[model samples]
Target: MFNSLQDKLDKALQNIQGRGKISEINVAETVKEIRRALVDADVNFKVAKDLTKRVQDKALGQNVLTSITPGQLMTKIVHDELVDLMGGHQEGINLSAKPSIILIAGLQGSGKTTFSGKLANFLKKKKNKNPLLVACDVYRPAAIDQLKVLGSQIGVPVYTEQENLNPVQIAEHAIEHAKQNQQDVIIIDTAGRLAIDEQMMNEIRNVHQFVKPSETLFVVDSMTGQDAVNTAKSFNDVLDYNGVVLTKLDGDTRGGAALTIRTVVEKPIKFISTGEKMDTLEIFYPERMADRILGMGDVVSLVEKAQEQFDEEEAKKLHKKIAKNEFGFDDFLKQIQQIKKMGNMKDLLGMLPGVGKAIKDVDINDDAFKHIEAIIQSMTPEERRKPSLINISRKQRIAKGAGRKLEDINALMKQFEQMGKMMKMMQGPQGKQLMNMMSKGMPGMGGGFPGMGK
Candidate 1:
């Protein structure tokens, strides 16, 4: 994600470290380094120059407080400037109209179809709206099929007319279908081109005219860097899009498009697509992004993701099991599954405060639990329920069945034992007191036992 740019910015700020105040020489060095970093990240030279100038002007004008070091003060100033450059506040999509229409427009391979399905899933699960995905990319039969496949995966109905060649007609007919079917939202996925062509622009314009969408989003591939910004400008020139969608942010983007697109097009980035998964869509927040860019983890977003995936009813049931000393391998496997559903392992861990910077260079694979899951699946129901009964011979058999080594099975057993002991401790008086304290401090930790406090 912007690892290179982050490193460069960190080094730039280090120039003023241990200094008593922001001196002219130090400010010049810092601003120059900052400008160089931006240019290296594929940002436009003019934009980088202008932004650094503003940052320098602000840095020199402010009175330096005696308590803070020059580096810390400068970092704060730069962070603020970055946020301002990226649209100071978060902007939400307008879904006020009944069957609110959202038209997706972008270049081909910009992830428009995938984003449309993700948006439908987000609206259905997060906003409690019945969304129908409309496939208007008639030029490519495969595109329509892709949308249909994604729609099926997310359990959302997709509206498409195979015989319809005109996207405007398809969108209009889809809207009429949504009204009749009581679908609360209609997301029309239109066709796109490999580049900015006149025919493609006119087709999208026709769809926009007919649908009159509450939100028209221009999706762009962040990996394209400056090209992404240029394409965004071109799209906005024709359609005047309401917002931007930056896709593939989980890839090695140089941070150019994210930093320059908002300033270039004057449109807030409404959503960011971190991965191809249906649940990978996230609302863009300028302050949080600045924190991430500065190597500070985004704890608020992490907590919100945890809350979204936390199941109250399931937690209650799990609490009863823990109280009965019945926390078994099955329960442990289920917990791992729930965590996997939250997001990628490194992404989830990086969201914790202080963890992102600590593990910046470490590689954390999302498939870390693959062997453990295989081992658990190899166990019989009785063995999973009563893991204590498994002897060395049984462990060998399980390991052989799971295609793993004996030591791996033993390690898993040790972890399970530790988890069981922790659950039992949570059933005691001291654990109850700890639970009460944590519940008072954490809003989502207000249940009976350890597992219950999701």
Candidate 2:
């Protein structure tokens, strides 16, 4: 997610580690480094200079109090400046009007269709609005099918007119259909070109005029770096979009678009698409993103993801089983399934503040739990309930049945045991103390283990 930029910024701040006070000479050196880091991240040169100047001025103005060190002060100033650069506050989609219309515009393969599905799912679940996805990409028949598949996966209805080639007419009819069906929101996914063209812009503009959308979102691939910012500006010039959606943030994006899009286009980043899955869409938060870029970890977002997946009834049942010391392979398998439902593992891990950089080089398969799931599914209900009763012969049989080796089964058992022990410890009085210590020692673990503290 911006690991390279984060490393550069961290190194830049480290240059003032031993400084006793914020002097003009030292501040200038640090500011220069900061500006260089932003430029390396693909930020617009002028934006980077303006931001660093503001940070420098803020640092120089601060009184040298014993409450914080120079390095800490500089980090704080830069954090605030980064937040301000990306929009100091969170901006939400406008759903004020009845049958609120949201028009999505972007270049082809920029993830516009996927983002439309994600946004519809987001509004349906988080905003409690009934959303109808309209397939207006008449040029590609596959585009309509893609939206339909996504709509089915998210349990959202998709409206498409296969016979009508005019997108404007399709959108107009979809809105009317929404009104009759009591759909609170209508998201129109229009066609796109490999590059920006007059015909594409005109088509989207015509739809925008006919729908008069409450919000028009410009989706851009962050992996494209500065080009993303420029495309955003062009789209904003044409459609006057209400917000921007930065997709493929989970990729090796240098953080250029995120830092400069708002400055260039004057539109807040409303959402970020971390993965190809529909559940991977997240509302953009400036402060959280700044924290992530600084390698400080985003605990707030981690907790929110946990809360969204937490079911009170399921929690109570699990608690009862744990209290009885009956937590076994079945429960563990169920837990894995629940986590898989949350989203892709790498994407979820990247949302954790420090884990993004740490795992940047590590190969984490999205199907890391495949073998574990297969082993569990091979077991009988009795075996799942009482894993301890399985002898060496049973182990070999289970391994063979799952098409895995005996060592694989043994390794899974070890991990399962460790997890059980940790859960037990978390349920103890000293758990909070231990958790606090671990949070400070290994921030990455804090992200993976949610709902254990607080």
Off by over 4 Å in 1: 18-22, 65-67, 426-454
Which parts of model 2 are misplaced by more than 4 Å?
18-23, 63-68, 350-357, 403-405, 428-454
Give, for candidate 2, the lowest lDDT window spanning 10 residues: 445-454
Query: How far off is residue 287 in model 2, in Å?
Result: 0.5
Best by TM-score: 1
Write candidate 1's Cα lDDT for 1-454 as tens digits.
6778988998898867755665688788889999999999988888899999998888778854333666778889999998998999999899999979999999999999999999999999999999999999999899999999999999999999999798887887898899999999999999988999999988898889888999999999999999999999998998998999999999988999999998888999999998888999999999999888887778888888888889999899889998888788898898989889899887777665556666677777788799999999999999988887899999999999999999999888987888788888988998999888875686664223232112
Judged by whole-model lDDT over C-alpha atoms, candidate 1 comes out at 0.88
Model 1: worst 10 consecutive residues (lDDT sum): 445-454
lDDT tens readout by residue for model 2, 1-454: 8878988998898888667765688779989999999999999999999999888778878853333677888899899999999999999878899979899999999999999999999998999999999999999899999999999999999999989999999998898899999999999999988998889889888888988999999899999999989988888888898999999988888999999999999999999998887888999999999998987778788888888988999899988887677899988988888888877676567767657766766677879889899999988899999878777898899999999999998988887888888787777778888878886786545444432222
Query: What is each predicted model's overall lDDT from 0 to 1?
Result: 0.88, 0.88
Give the clash count for model 2.
2
Task: Please count the clashing residue pairs in each candidate, in the order shown.
Answer: 0, 2
